[model samples]
Target: MTEAAACGIDGVDTGLADPPLLVADGVTRWYGHRLGCRDVSFRLWPGEVLGIVGESGSGKTTLLDCLSGRLTPSDGTVTYRTAGGETVDIFSRPEAERRLLQRTEWGIVRQNPRDGLRMGVSAGANIGERLMAAGGRHYGRIRALAGEWLERVEIDHDRLDDRPTTFSGGMQQRLQIARNLVTHPRLVFMDEPTGSLDVSVQARLLDLLRGLVARFGLAAVIVTHDLAVARLLAHRLMVMQQGAVVESGLTDQVLDDPQHPYTQLLVSSVLQA
Candidate 1:
């Protein structure tokens, strides 16, 4: 892929000629009288990492939820291209089918590891359950894969029998990542993934995540308030403010030469910090 293709420059042919993995068009959500997000549209190609950045109440999380199918939009549609090469509107599909897509083809990494992890279960069980959901039934193979994933995420294999509740915050987050990626989902949705970690821990986790995403050729949509994280991980960026996308483009271009006033302010604040 060319730099233009990797950075998602508009009108630049990516050469792969493959259709987008996911598409969200005119997506809007309303909290009764208030707006959550409005008219958010984007195409996520395979292996692309798109970041959504904004401060609290900027509607980035709301947009992420709508795009990931955790919450249905009041208006607009979320369409996904299946592994079988069929495009389907997620909301229009049967609930079971939509859920099956989530379980088998899509992964969600919540901001809080606790929200994503089954804390009461053994760490090995957590990883194994996802494999089982995707049709793994052999106990020995499942156990082996779980151990392998733990090691891949830089966690000790011996921790497999332990519960997430007993692990440190960073370990729990790593375990959550292992569980999500064990199924090899084509796309992943992340919301404030490193938000709660200490700076050192967050940096290490980010490096791990970057490598894993590359190794798996995963497409991701990450929502975060931190521009530094966005710069590090995202190929393209969409800057949100006041429930709408104020600006969007290649990550470097938007961050380095912001076109919108709000985006400029955001960039300056990060530089000042």
Candidate 2:
């Protein structure tokens, strides 16, 4: 796509002045003869939230995995601009380097909190582990920060000693979030963060997520089947269908006046339900 088209998709006239925090250029992932995602491309600026909305089998999760370096694309590149202003293609980096990036500068929130949290460890330990990996060593400092994060996520600091396995699903998910954010990651990849929660719990968690993302000025790519979740947390929306981006623009514009037939159907479905 041309530069103008790219900028237009984002609904912003950045004029290519500032560098994007993350860039996915023609990112494609295939499972043998089956396609996962095809030729996905977009630019995510700092502090912006981009939501990928699609139904199951639409390949949003595959695109997210490739973008997050958890899966390698069959073709194309996922380049990231580091905190220090250096851009690197994530796939080209060494495994250790990519792991370091995942530990330090990036955070991933799995749809299932169990996948993200250390279920066997105390809540404090879960958060502090990330801090320690980022070079934090002072025991008192780590514990204190962990407690602070627990509170930030609306978990009682008194539960710091409890294992996540004992917490409610929503609480476990919040604990997972606290663990991820304690490292102050610049970019976060969320796969249906509130997908498994009850409606009331999802609302509270979604509010918490919105506040945290805005407060930290985080750049994030979130994949969710629920358009409501996308509407709440994302500044822009990318509508995926049959493994390709069918439409993308400012969240309100795309949802309110979708151009593509797939996007229109998605909106109508949501409204009719």
Candidate 3:
């Protein structure tokens, strides 16, 4: 049996499964005197997708940043289990080691492709860079792998040399996905990946994302305001309000029957929309 299966963390397991990939405890963050996120705690198991949903300033993004190690929480701890089965506190790890871990074992997809992709580089080069960082030295092999990932994300091999500046919004987002997934990271953090796309485009991108996430059995945490997105992509849901998680549970249960007043309001508003 594989290590994941041996640890009862099979890719098909739920968020409640054992041998969690990442764990956050009493996580709280503040921007100056303003609270960003407060008293957040959760576990992300292998292959589970957790959606953090809230309004623009509800602190979902702040919590996500803290979880992904981009921003440190003022209080609490975030620990990640390495692929080697070692648990390490993200904040306590050496800076270089943490950077390497993110580059190799983790992925982050930003709301803006410009933040994630190197606009000046070719699409192929963008993908190749990650492989190179992981010690891929053969130019031919890197380019070939890049081509495969492009196709995997439904981008044509013909556009391998095109810069992201030349692509459409949807296409740029797809490229960003390819670049992030090329290394086959175990955990991925996404922030409103489809928020800027047209409705139809968003639909297509979400479908693509769903397939890729399942295909790889990725452990993901996605932050978005759209309940529809959380419904489609996440197995579990976390509803944030005013820097606090007001509700969390299985997506279907929470969305169908929200217990928190704030969550009820959010759900009703989405339904009305």
Best model per lDDT: 2
Q: Judge candidate 1 at residue 13 and give its lDDT.
A: 59
Task: TM-score each candidate.
Answer: 0.94, 0.96, 0.93
Each candidate's lDDT (Cα)? 0.93, 0.94, 0.92
Model 1, range 1-273, lDDT digits (tens) per residue?
223347676777557576899999899999999999999888899999999998999999999999988899999999999999999999998889988998899999999999998988999999999999999999999999999999999999998999999998898889999999999999999999999899899999999999999999999999999999999999999999999999889999999999999999999987554
For model 3 the local lDDT of residue 45 reads 89
Q: List the residue pairs that clash in candidate 3.
A: none
Residue 78, model 2, lDDT: 95
Query: Is candidate 1 or 2 superior in TM-score?
Result: 2
Candidate 3 ranges with C-alpha deviation above 4 Å:
1-17, 271-273
- List model 2 lDDT by residue over 1-273, tens digit each: 434556665566656788899999999999999999999998899999999998999999999999999999999999999999999999999999999999999999999999999889999999999999999999999999999999999999999999998999999999999998999999999999999999999999999999999999999999999999999999999999999999889999999999999999889898543
Question: Candidate 2 at 241: error in angstroms?
Answer: 0.7
User: Sorted on lDDT, highest at the top, how do the candidates line up?
Assistant: 2, 1, 3
Better of 1 and 3 by TM-score: 1
